[model samples]
Target: MMLPTRLQGSLNNELNDGETILWLDQPIASRMARGAWPIVLFGIFWSTFCAGWMFFTINMAMKTPADQAGLFAWLFPAFGLPFCIIGLGMLTSPIWVRRLALRTVYVLTDQRAMIISRSFGKTHVRNYTPEKLNDINRSLNDDGSGDLIFEKVISSHTHTHRNTHSLGHGGHRAGGGRSSRTRTSTTTYGFKCIKQAKQVHELIDGMVLASKPVAEQD
Candidate 1:
């Protein structure tokens, strides 16, 4: 298939001399942003804390007598300035992600699958070659549009540990049971929320299978 008109210039530089583009399309921006609320909520919580800290600190500084106020009073309030800015960035990230979805393109070629993204004023091309097509998963929706996951990157998570201790004859010799919970996050790379996801998945599977050595297929 031919590359979209808008994407041609951005992608031509990245394509191989003889590479065949089998499919090309942009993700549904709304779908790309479906997972945004969690992050926004977390951002709100984070910013609230930071903002609260700064407010209270500054209020205290203002109440202090001019001659009695020390350098630490004003300095401590400034510490939260950067953190609050970071929190605000997070709070607005979902909107930014949605906008980026408009600029993002997903392509599948005989040689590879690619996600061409424009982020922070730079173009990023993420490729998954036929050799790396060991695992391909899909999530379908009733509307006949869904996601085809080619890559999953789990960035690491915050883990909370809780321990329950029972005192035996001696506290030093007591046995303890541990319980832990974690808030894990994963970044999925795919042709997200596109039409005919099943067909695209099957087509890519076929292409990958055809690329494999006969012995490997057997």
Candidate 2:
């Protein structure tokens, strides 16, 4: 499927001359499936927890003596009402996270790269000619999902520092502390958690090499 024209227009104006192409870090379907599993598991656990709390509250309220009844019974409904509402609200985060997870995006224009990451709105962009790319590779996880990897797409000419961080602290923190350090390294674009990563890597490798001038090859 193609991005709507309005979204296409939002691409940087500098990307005008050459064709624009998009790729996902993983297939959209695979991502959706992966994302849904967590939500389902969460619902199951949440329901169990709520049921336990409800049962406990009701039981405790029954055990109170009639003379003390006014206190515990009134307290039960007040506390339960809020707890129930909050438990329902917990559903929101997973749904939103799952929706975002279903997408892994890459935009390749004549001279730069843009990557939209998983389960969140983190977008990473890089500006560099193909000649600057040092290498490209495909990476896969044990679960058989993967993403294309672009190594060293930063060079002196295409480099700019306008956009600093993509997929900030929370997005990458789950995989560990890899993204925490502050540094002055050049930014590169890669497919993150997409299916068929190797295939995308090869396609990019070919495109980068083909874009090179004969003099550069020599």
Candidate 3:
């Protein structure tokens, strides 16, 4: 599908010489509705509870005399502030995600796949070359819109540290402590919530095959 004029203009300026656009599209709005009900419910519960706590704390603080209020009265409102803000943010996250989709564009080119996103007054672009891609997967929604995960990169790190503590026994001291921590993170890249994801996936696969050298094709 042809992109809108404004979107096309922005993409055109970013294209490399002789690179051709094969497919381009934005995410569907209903994408937000998929697997979002649980989050929405949690947000509602969290925000309602936090707001009530905030109001109650503020009212109690106001009713307490300044001299008697002390640190406890002041601390209550301070404690409630972060939770209130976080809850409100959670409640509004779905709306934010949907709005973000409006400014996001996905492009498939002969040489690479590109994602253009404009958020918080910043424009960011991500490009993935076919040769560098790994573990391509797809998840389709009932309505034929889905996500194409072209790469899954898993990174792991482990750290070990020793601590010494003094143990006094008959004028002798001994100490030893060892701790280890491991962290794993997985990052997936590709078109998210695009229509005709299977078709797009197949098209990209064909492009990748065609881009291979003649000797590699055999």
Number of the top-ranking candidate, with TM-score as the measure: 1
Candidate 2 C-alpha lDDT tens digits along 35-83: 5565556766776687788888778778888888787585774566665
Listed in order, each prediction's TM-score against the native is: 0.78, 0.48, 0.77
What does candidate 1's lDDT look like per residue over 1-218, in tens digits?
45445566678888989999888888888877877778889999999999899999999999999998989889989999899888988888878878888778888888999999876768888889887776878889998899888788877665666566667775664656666666768888778889889988888888899788999886
lDDT rank order: 1, 3, 2
Candidate 1 deviant stretches above 4 angstroms: 1-7, 155-185, 213-218
- Itemize residue pairs with steric clashes in candidate 1: none
How does model 3 score by TM-score?
Answer: 0.77
| Best-to-worst TM-score order | 1, 3, 2
TM-score (C-alpha) between model 1 and the true structure: 0.78
TM-score of 2: 0.48
Better of 2 and 3 by lDDT: 3
The residue pairs that clash in candidate 2, if any, are: 25-194, 26-194, 26-195
